[model samples]
Target: MTENLPFIEITDIIQSLANKRSTGTLELSRDGEPTTYLFFREGMIQHLKAPRSQVILGKALYQLNLIDEADYELTLSDYAQTGRRYGEVLAELGLVSEEGLRQALSFQAREDLQNVLTWKQVQTRFHGSSQPLSDVFSESDLEFELQMGGMSLLMEAARREDEWSLVREHIPHEDDVLRLSAPGAIKAEDLEVRITLLIDGYRSAYEIADAAPCNTLECLHQLAELVREGKLVTLEPLELIELGHEAELDDDHEKALKLYQLARSRGQDGFDLRRRIARAHHMLGHKQEALERWLEVAERCAEAERADLAIATLKEVIELYPTDLHLRQRLVPLLVANAAKADAALQLRNLIALAETNGESPQLLTDLMNQLLELDPSDRPTLKALATLHREEGDGVLAMGRLDELATLEVEADRLEEAILAYREILEIDPENLNARLRLAESYAGLGSTDDAVAEYRGLADILYNSGLIANSINWPFLIRVYESIVELEPSSTPAWEWLAKAYIENNQRDLAISRYLGMAQSLRPTPGEPPSPALISPLARVVELDPTRLEVCYELAHTYLALEMRVEAGRTLRQLAEEALRQEDVPKARSAYQEAIEIDPFDLVSRRGMAALHELQGDLDLAFGIWLLCAELCQRVGLLSEGRSDARRALAISASDPRALKVSAALEALAEEPQAAAALLLRYAEIMHERENSGLALEAIAQARRLDPARVARHPLLSLLSTGNTPRSGAPLR
Candidate 1:
């Protein structure tokens, strides 16, 4: 095992680099843990990369309240599209000021450094670069590099560690709860109100630290101080025990053990508590004391007539002590008496092995094997022994039954060759056993013996057909070849023909697929006003796939896809059909196609846009406006705000002077929570109305803008002209 080095040694390594003014990347790694990378430039720590634990800049900004959810999501979307750094994206989006970013970056660095200082046994390597960091890192990565003095950071870390050590006695664990000694008692000497308000006797120190706006280290230190001053206290031992029980129930044995130990040290003790402690130990690793305690508990449970609980306790002990012969010997009879014969047989087998290892007599071996086989017939050793015994006695029929069981087990274990030999033996004894023959065929298929499997399946298929049960036997994949033979033998069999065509499709021989269906379609053309033949669905779809000019076939394929509940495929088919309809100047057909496409896949942008266009061409401006606005809202929801804006612009273009259109455009901007953008669009609408000398509409637009941003509306240049009932002197736009 690698021993932990002193923390001072790590600080010294970093300090020596600062003293030498070295520039490089220092990588720290530990066994089975993620590596940490620290970048230095002219002796200053510029960046730290810990893939496992680094706090991303965007998350830091959000945690610090420097950016809200809407802005953060938009920044992520913009960053993903542009491949830019998060800090750059935040600044580009104008969501965070320079100072705010600086603070967030510093917070990120401090949090990462705190994590680094906790590692004491990491192997370190420094790759020195002759080139400056500006050249070494990409511009995007270097643009927001943190400028932290290495020695100063080390000193600060050391100071925090020292303070934490002083407070460790009171706040030894993050989950240690703190409550006010007297409720409503204010201790304002040095504590922040946020910290005091969070001391509601429920939240742990880590939770309080997370809930507060301040750094974790500072919040923890304040909480520790409160405990030291006797103004706060930890949870009582009983309460701690309750928490440990809760942790145990949650399957967190490690945490539960720690809490239990802490409670024990605080003078909590009882027989039931000791039993719980023993169970926790057993669940964790089955220590010697835990085994002994559980054995004692099992005896007491038996004395109390709790057979189920006693059996469960003994089973737990046996799982950890599988080789303890006495334990299994004791457990087998109990399991048998409890009507758990399967479990009893398993334990009895273990006992037999222990007896053999101890040089006990083999006199009971046959009887034990017989009993085990009665409970689990698939037990390989017992089945093998019985088969050998029956063969030695010349009882071939009884021997074949044991062989059958062994063959099933071998097949389940994927020992197909062994299973095949056993099945061949069984067939020799009973040549007409169709079940064995079917199993042999399936085994051949499983082993990739396709030709052999096909021969067997074909024979079985012929027999089943003569027996009038072929329909029930053609479901296996290997039977597809049987269907092929049937199609050749009976050319007039429609079901056989259909099955062969489907098999051809599955095999990707699409050119050969649906041939019979195409023949049927050709033979039976639908008369006028009569429903099309159902068999034509496949052929029509195939025709549309081959030739896009088959408009009627395309419509039939769309209906077929819908009937099968394949809506996505149906929507795509309809969209293509709509595009073709538009090319043919069939406006009504195009509109119906687009409408069907939208109904199937309401979020499909292409169909919605096509439908909106059709509505516009048909002189239904109101219907067109609703679809365009819906498209904008959908785009915004998917982080395509720019596309959403374009959609909103399309809506505005439909009816520029419509008040509802202007308000709808403003609402799209509000989706991004940008009141400024929303108010600007409203103001732009007001300006356009004033230029048209429409005072009433212009005032209405100004009133809507005021609702979004009163200050911007109050200071607008056109506000005075519209209020005084005069057109703007110049039509210059208000930005």
Candidate 2:
């Protein structure tokens, strides 16, 4: 048995003992906290005791609401006065029955075990003893012993820990206070409701968790859920400070600053406030603002005893005035006083960079580099600055040597790739350096051996997807190569196939992607009771998007949909195929496709259009005209005037005297600025009306033609005699 808990987990220890059917006591301790003891009898947890008073069986009963507060107080008093076990005291006082006491003890033991499992930083020791913990358990208590399965406890603890990690993000600080936003509107289960009712604006989340009837983690999890559901809200720490007692304002500079920030946001402004704000900023490591604000009151920050602030302010000011050596000279003492050696070195390096930018003298830059190296002898930035200085002085050999040293340092710091790139730079200068080539190859192999290229490509894909560039034609070639590589390396990879299919669709290779997906689906043999894989559905859908005219793809898609018992989707795909067939003027195919579509969805428009188109193609003129008229009316009713006009034209081409067709065609012709065409159509309408013995309507149609084109109507033989109430002779050419 392991005596100490260093790297070993408590769960592992418990599970090992249970597997071996060992009998002993396990003790766990943390510094300044009382030790927890667990007694096992033949691998089962016979009893457990938590050091915390909250885990006592009597307290657990009170928390669980199995006993009232008065009963709990009496039980505690009797146990204290008689030195009897708490469960015995509860049974003797009749506060709880033997069965209720047993249940409470079991609950208490589970809570203790859960708490013990979370003690990752604590010390644990196990002692193998022949004697049972007779001191802790009486004979009657042994009869109702709380036996917990170690494996179940371990699993529950692990689940709770995972849940706690998510919950902690929302309720990050224990000091965070939450208040009920809408007490009346919170509709939750009994446990959540109980936790919600405990939430008051004054209590911290930790307090609410402690006061709830469940374990602390369970209470917090419910609280986080309530917050997400908008039934509760967390109060900011600054807001809590205002709601707190007045004495909280003194001594704590951080809290005072928060209060002042709140005040400023509320429109409180003055010079005193600014000074206080500046002082707070200085004390809180906001170095730049402290100096600027102090300079407004005192000419120099040194007068305010904040030399660090002065140095930071000078750095900021020097960025704007790089040639100001006096300011740099003033910053030196403050930098030394503040122990800012690296920052001092950085300031000198900045001056050197500025001198290079302004094309200053090399001697001046050399003096700056020497001063920088004096402050921090191994400053890489200053060393690089010196290297630049040497290279500008036409010292190529010295510059290359400096770069070699820097690369060696990078390698020692475990930046192998950066070192390799530096070596490549040397080869760029020399070109025949075999050592540089070997090192670069070694670095490349090292990175490739990690097998993170797939992950890197996945990350790149994510970036492109987020940036809305994943579907860009320019990125398609690179994305295709990445996805193909992943699939080639990991042949059974589903995500790779999905990404590759997407790339194919975006790159206009939909048919190829569809074929690949169908092959993939054929390879998968689904379980007897399960649906087909979603991977099969994606590529089929992409094919339809690419070209809905592909009846073969539609057939495969519909079959796949039917295999998944998705009748509605299957019907939709069939309708797409039927519409595409109708568009291609394949009458027999359209008729067959429409029959199938109508069987799936009787009211679908695709089937209606297919049937109408089939009738028209078969030359059943009257029946076709009637179906076209119905289609026109449907289109017109749905505000599709262009489609309505097309249908009406089709009907008129089949039968010249179709009433709806003539009316729609005449109107469309007038809108198209063809007044003579309109006049001719209305004259034909009049002839049709005249044949039906509707003389009044025939005269009305003639009047409409005259209004459309008076000159054309006068020239028309049938329409010219409209005012005389005379019809044209039989077999007269209206044209």
Candidate 3:
């Protein structure tokens, strides 16, 4: 710093410090040595925290909650800015104010506040607080006390003086960014920068002059630049401020005059100083002695409260002299009703009432009235708001007593139904009001009301449904109990039956749902001892019983039995059902289903013929013949159809003699006459005759050809064809 300029003079900041208005921390320097400090509205230095540079950066950013380790590295990376204050960068970063930057620079300039404050009023140190800076610091806008000499000397001046309207700083680094510290600015390009090469730590500011050989002032100019950018920071050492003497004051005298005129003048705001004073007296066992002091505070606070300064006064009392009983008691109900803790508020209430005051003020009674209003809770719509409030405040037994009294009064007023309704309301609000449900049910039962009793039971069911703790085995039993009462009231209830079935299903008893329907199906059964004649099951009713799922159920069951070697039983059941379908004239179902049954027992000739006859009635000649052939083979195998195949054999024989059979025979013979590929011709005719169910016809055709021309018939393909005269037994034996 220039030796010609004096160090920073602290006398300049006395008034703002005393009034609790100026806040941000401080830094000072002297003789090129950096010192760090904090100035609070609370007056006493907050903390000297660290060296000037670190603390200055920390406190400024701390105001913005941005001083985490992350921001320091970010700022260093971008140290060059077109001319602007460090506080502008801080403002852009939203860390500090334009007014704050001016004050910081002015403090670093050792300026007078009246002079500093006057200069501020005369010229805008920063962009208007609201207009907010964007860029540019004008030379006309800033005038610094030139600290002439070397770089280090100028840095020293920047730190010590607390006066300057603006700053310009020079920074050295590998890469640079211009940081504007004003809140906002106008076209900032005219702002200037001075970049320097940082020398090794050993080099003094004089060496900077050597490095800048053509400019001796380069060192001084660099240091001046650094200061403007807020890179230089330090604090002047302190000698405490004197307010007034405490020695002559009487401890018990009137407070407003004595305390303010003497002790509080130096405090940032008197409340903070008064708190420490109260604490000292409190710790010294001067409770009654200090009562007079607390009374003055409470009186000041009460006056503030009456003037609607309640929030500030309350904060002062609570955060400061919190142990005062009169103050706490007066404030507790206000706090509680406003959503503060009730128990803490109550503790203060109880303690204050117990205090040994010689005589109470009307304020005390007024406090009691408010507290009582908060305490009473008043009445309610359904809940008796008072009782509900207490219950919610966690006094359940108290709630119960209130309800009991209500119930008694209701009974005396001959409102039994209302009393019952009240009880029901409780149960509605908390359905686990099992005692009420039981009492209500008994009341209904006393009046011989089954419907009311049933309603109570259903309410219990709703509870069980919600809780899910009803025992699994007993659920149906409970449902049945409700159902019995329901039916007792209305005998023809379909919904009751449905609910019972659903309950059975929920318990996984599928047979129960089907059993009732099955009994209906079976009641239509012919009498008890008679065989199940197909006539016994009505076609429509049987259709319903044998629903799609039931059809699948029986089909799957049969396959399972077949797989388990119970083929005969599977066949018996399937054939009977298929025959039943045929009697109903469901021809396709009878044909295919009986065919499948016959397939399960290849030896059952009757089963096979029964299938063939159904197919024939449906005009499926090929299918009829195929089933007939299977019956013939099965019968012949078991020797059952060798002679008596019932109408199936007769029908098959009749169809085999048809005129279409003759056409098949003719096609086979004409195709055999093609000599070049007689084998291919024979095979083609065989496929057609086979598809047409003329295997018998094809055999018979060979017999006819032999009768016409023996050599040709004998020479035809197939094992039976080679036997001439004696007809090789015709037709494939059906499977």
Candidate 4:
């Protein structure tokens, strides 16, 4: 809520000392209707819940302090929970003259939206010690901070001439199409005026936004939310933007080249324009030309003193450009040098999600982060990135420093355990960091530590409990594990037996983990909010599916079905879990998630990639390999190749080769194994190259040598003799 905070100021907060925390809302619009939005850094507008009407919107805003004191509190007492609009609230109170209510209505119509937050408009009246803004709230609530800082931003932005008011609801949106209230409410008797704008039609959305000080974002977000909710009915645009700079060409390459020429000659031939043309060049069988064009865009953007723009354009170029040792050697570190301020966090969020979505190379992550760290100086993210890079590069101890700082700041910032592992990492260094030792114990317990994980849970428990604290949230799973361990050690603690039973149910192990749940179920005891356990589901269902619920067991069910492509069964199982969550009041979100039985397999890759696991489990390598091959192929087709490669290599490691993979690789032209087939394919390629003299003699020679020694060929012995039959091949005569 500070005035005129520049983008640089936001970055300053991003780079601030002592973790200056604020939840950001890029104020999209305040003109349309009184609505708020939640947009992630990934450029996704997740939810757009709006007010029921303008009067209700104004009332909320008045209460939050956009209105003068007299207007806000006067009608406040007369407000009814089940009542209608604010103008009516005023009528009931009789504080405002009829003229005043009409005046309010007039103002409401001209103003499109009012974003409101409670914390910003008023300070806490509670008397106590001062605390960090974040510490004043419950662990479960983000509202305190939102009300304080976020709320004012909403109000200020709402009062803006054209932006949509940003509002926060107690409940996050579960529906794709959320209901937002318009700013003006008429009496129910006034049927014509009572009609709220639909805001669903694109034309309607634009008109609403245009009514006052408008931010395109509010409209965009509403559209995004509608699209997410299945509420958005997309109509084909009457005027689709077409390529008009140049006429269509005979082929893709000609089209790309012609487009590039046209842009350079006529269009907005800046970085983005040229970059787009360069990308087309790559796709249209002109890779070198594409690279050159991208380089040209980068050079131009750089010379124009638009370094940030240059960085973005260059990154795009890097993504499209063919990666090579020489190019990557010069390119990777340079990308770091050119990356813009605050772009790391933004890029990481966008790229990781994109990488996840598109199944792009994870090497992209490594490269981007590494450059970010190297280029940026002492920035927290940069420092942390350095730490992650070290750990990823097998320098765990080295990473400990960065992880430690991150953990401290993260914990101080109330980030939970997202960074605490770094604190535990210090253990490997000090082996006696008693403070870190205690923190590590807490961390392990937080991670659902088993009894055998470490022997210090009791110590941690004793310390916290004796000191009159909550004892690390009394994690029932960890307690069960501890009790189970005690049972193993002493074998007959009645307390252990009783606690284990209770813990079993809390830990979601109904039938097997504790037979006592079933025993308790038959007792027909009401367990708090739950129905008498026996009637919850059939006792028959419990008895029907009782096996040790190993991680593998959970996965095997999901994986086997997926391996067979049983979408209905997969979706059914997923839906049940989702429905269970829904019953728990976890709203159905638009994102793919697991409900009762998670059909979404975050851990299924393990079962599919049985590398050492297959060996260790006394399972068949051939079967595991078959499984991995199938999963890899399926995952690859779905653009989950990183998942595929991890599994594929694990499977490949079992026997060092798979001709089928080679064939598949041969078909896709990306797999780098089974050199005999690959080499044979290359030989054929070389002959074509030599006959056509593709590019030049240098290209033909390169292809010939490549058949002998293809670069980055996966380590397979056959690749060694991959040349023409010039050397003795296993049993073939030496030439």
lDDT of each: 0.75, 0.68, 0.44, 0.44
Q: TM per model?
A: 0.38, 0.33, 0.20, 0.22
What is candidate 3's local distance difference test score? Answer: 0.44
Report the C-alpha lDDT of model 3 over 599-712, residue by residue, as the tens digit.
887666667777666666767778777655544444444444323333333543656444433333333333334232333333334434544655664565445555545665
Candidate 4 TM-score to native: 0.22
Model 2: per-residue Cα lDDT over 1-735, one tens digit each: 435546577888899889987787787787768888887878888877665645777778877778987787788788789888788787777778867877787887787778778777667777777545666545654565567878888888889879888787777666567886765756666346667667767666877888776667778887887777777787754555464323134555554555555555546544445456566666677766665654443234666786755666666655544675655656765787688877777677666676777777888877787787678765666666676677779776666666676666766777777776676666656554545554554454455532333333344455456668675332346657877787777666667776676546444576767765654455453667877775677767766776777777777787678788787888777777777776776656667767776677665555666677677667676777777777766766676667666877878878877765887777766766678887888888888777766778888988989998998777866654555666566545454
The candidate scoring highest on lDDT is 1
Q: How many backbone clashes does candidate 1 have?
A: 0
Which regions of candidate 1 deviate over 4 angstroms?
1-8, 52-95, 131-140, 187-190, 244-311, 314-344, 348-735
Better of 1 and 4 by lDDT: 1
Q: Candidate 4: deviation at residue 326, Å?
A: 11
Q: Model 2: runs farther than 4 Å from truth? A: 1-6, 63-65, 73-89, 132-144, 182-197, 214-218, 240-735
Candidate 3, number of clashes: 43
| Reference-based lDDT, residue 237, model 2 | 41
- In angstroms, give how far residue 131 of model 1 lies from its true place: 5.9
- Minimal lDDT window, size 10, model 4: 167-176
